[model samples]
Target: MKKVLFGLLLAGLMSTTQAAVAQSGSGPAVSYTETVLAAEIGKEILFRRALDWTENHFSYGPKTGAKSDAAAGTVRVTGTGKVTPVATNGKELTRVIRFDFVFRATDKGYDYSVGSFRVIPDPQKPEETMMLSDYIAQLATEKGNGKTFNDRRVTAQANALASEAAMSFRSFMNTMPAAEENTVGIPATE
Candidate 1:
């Protein structure tokens, strides 16, 4: 009976699930990349606020592609990801999850970024893990009852990615070549 239940649970939980990935360009991204991102309502709002009071940015890395002749060039980016629960509780009441992120970026003919990654869940979230496990287990048995679950999951994912992406960009752009880092401090010992 336990084996039958586990099999049915796995089958149901796997069928309706999808994954998400949030990424950024690394090498020779075009200007439109930021423009495209700024169009997002959440991003625009966050960036506007971030720019107002933050003095952060990314140092410009070496350019990878040829110089643009047509005013501005373009970039193409892609990512593949999978989020899977790594471990299930003895009673299937707890779960440890891992999100494998495989990402790459290109511009014209040059490669920008490529990497694989994962999400390491917080250790203190054992209770949340148990709750999620119960939810997934329920999702398996309850069938269409996951309507609310799906909706909540989608909204949570969207908001999280948008928020994180915006913060990352705010930090990144503040460190670039042209960013002014105003400070008053004694020079550090070398």
Candidate 2:
């Protein structure tokens, strides 16, 4: 009877841990979509600007940059970047994150989405980025009461990076010359 009781208690604890972990929600992939201003101008300029932005902000090799399917009116880009964790007088750690960006162009405007982000600890080993809930769970375990990690701050920084990327494309569009009639490709299939 004592053995049975002990087994039951252990099972209960395991279930509680599973429940707590499950409650932490999905990961740190933040999806963002925006309508770009120069859709009618052709996707070429958009692709170019996106490539430039990726090169400047994210680490990309000579062969990397925007991948576009003109017939499908879609462009995708994937890259990784290193961000320094804010100062806490801590270890001065830098985190590397990878992201996927997709852009779909239309006649009047273009839609872009950014997501599929993860933290890459080593060139060979990549880990899922922690969501705000996951950080909160860590805080609880550490009894940090917000001292262990600033989840909100990290989230804000991620958002700011995304916003900056969008703004870069927008700025490029604003300064872009209108497309010549002959240069514009056929409208993408419905």
Candidate 3:
């Protein structure tokens, strides 16, 4: 009887954990409908993710410095970014992050960076996760209060990662040998 009661209690507790935080997924891979050289002019990244939102949404579109669906080249990028507080100095914090963007050929490749791609915010937690490894320390405990949510340290760290990802892609687009285009493919598809 004691075992049965404990089992029921465990089940009840697990449900609340699901309710308190956002879920992470393997995410979508970047795919393109048109070849880079054959893309149109204004087409953009047109894809979504598997996360839910309730409030304080940070929806982004195109490369307008803010958020818009209008894109310059043919590729449309759409993905989710999570921010977790690693270290906080008042309102400022560092963040660890992981985001996957699906890239579809729109018209043509543009000068914009992946950072220019849309960032879908997780309203439930605000802070999101990119790679599973970042939260290894948090996962050990079965019960997490989502202490990582909107963690500025995590956010800053993740943003920095995104910036670095953009630079690597920039280098690939401009510097990769033309003959390797087929072998290497789109710069941001990874």
Candidate 4:
């Protein structure tokens, strides 16, 4: 009976420790999303604008691509950006960060989510990559001074990039297209 009670206590302590570790290491990823209210905008028009905005916003690299479905009123884009964070050792670590953009259009407005971030340790080897969340978690558990500095820097840089892109997208979406000329009243001549 004593042995059984001791075993139960040990198991409880281990579970508590594991839970604390998990909670401490896990955190929010650097991502951003927004829903813009555009009164009177049709879904088709919004979708077209979304496509145009995506094309103009991100320079298509070999790793970047976009897909648009008019019927579904959605545009999904996978884009990449370069981030150079100075390590604790004062060495600049440059990495390629891949992110996702999803634009969903409605008659009332559109919703956009611009983050599903992953970091490629080596740009040459795209497959060797890790999610930003995992990298941040690892950084959080790392030992030594300035460990959090890198974590903060990486998070800030990624968030900044995402915010900038989102802001630009919002501004572009808010702009009204030029009005078409009224050719019905004027006689056609060549």
Candidate 5:
């Protein structure tokens, strides 16, 4: 009975440790990339769509610093969003996540890559920032006390942000915009 109980206890401890490592960003940094196929769509039209999508997705009254080069058929956008991770004490910790969106328009479709994730732990101290992957690795190395809970929350939130951005952009790019009416000098029938 004693040996059985000891074995069970050891198993539990090992599982707990494994869970901590998994939650602590033991793998690579979070990023998303996808290639979208738009049949019968010209490069210029796709370029315009990419610009419009960036503006709609990232703009909140202020300029999103989205730039596009028609000649090169590329659009670049820098985006920032907030993620709230609850601490062990149940207090919400707000972190700002910054990422980049690059869209390359081709004759048949477009390719987009979203990456370069950085997290600003404190909004007041913007200069003190670190990569999301680094933060997770640091958390993984810490003593597994109650801190692991918060660490897990942080990793989950950051990953969710990356996934959301990538999936939303993919959905937008897959859609077809309504055709614009060339109503120059046309009288209104209504």
Candidate 6:
């Protein structure tokens, strides 16, 4: 019975999970990448709020490939989308990365996790995406063989990508509207 229960739990977690890779201290580390916020609102209200926010911001609607579930005082959403990087010279890089995002919400707040990040080489070309993990591993391989300028460039790009995504998520949550109170914003007698 214990094994069965554990299996079920593991399955549930796996059902809604994805990536975060560690970058050189300058950026958000993917190691155990999970964010949890606290709010003084009801679970259902918070869940609905989160659903509305993501649906509005994310490119696709819930019915259009985004997975969402609300139950047991928790809400979970998973979706795939692309993030664009901006260059220092006020130019935006055309190369976009496809990423998997997992969001979990509760009465207090919510948690967002991004992983399975891959670069989509060309929009007009066939999908030839490379996983950020694989790219990082290749950098390690190159470092072992003595680092070159290209290796350093790749490392910097990966780190910047991680930083960009992290900031975007943080900003989104930070800017979310404050929980609204019902009935003239006054405390009701029990």
lDDT of each: 0.30, 0.57, 0.37, 0.78, 0.73, 0.53
Model 4 worst lDDT run, 10 consecutive residues:
176-185
Give the alpha carbon lDDT tens digit for every residue of 7-101 in model 3: 99999999878765435321232222222442322233221110111012224321122233333222333444444443223353333233443
**Candidate closest to the true structure, highest TM-score:** 4
Higher-lDDT candidate among 1 and 5? 5
Error of 4 at 174 (Å): 1.3
Q: Tell me the TM-score of each prediction against the true structure.
A: 0.26, 0.57, 0.28, 0.74, 0.74, 0.52
Residues 1-190, model 4: lDDT tens digits: 9999999999999999999856653458788988888646677778888898888765534446679899989999888887776666778888888899899998788899889999897668978889988876666656632543566677778888899778878887777565412333566899
Relative to the true structure, candidate 2 reaches a TM of: 0.57
Q: Alpha carbon lDDT of residue 139, candidate 1?
A: 40
How many steric overlaps does candidate 6 have? 4
RMSD of each: 17.4, 10.7, 16.0, 8.8, 5.7, 15.7
lDDT per residue, candidate 6, 51-153, as tens digits? 6656776542222245667775433333334444333443544455555556677656666665555656566763587775565455445433232333345
Poorest stretch of ten by lDDT in candidate 1: 21-30
Q: How accurate is candidate 2 locally (lDDT)?
A: 0.57
Question: Candidate 6, overall lDDT?
Answer: 0.53
Q: On residues 11-125, what C-alpha lDDT tens digit does candidate 5 reach at each position?
A: 9999999999666554666778878776467788888878888877653223356788999899988788766756556677777777788899998788888778777877899
> Which regions in candidate 4 have their CA more than 4 angstroms from the true location?
1-26, 59-63, 144-148, 180-190
Candidate 4 similarity to native, TM-score = 0.74
Give one digit per residue, the lDDT tens place, for model 1 in 75-158: 222221222322222121122332111111122121122221222234466223322323343444444433334323422343
- Model 5 / residue 57 / CA error / Å: 3.5
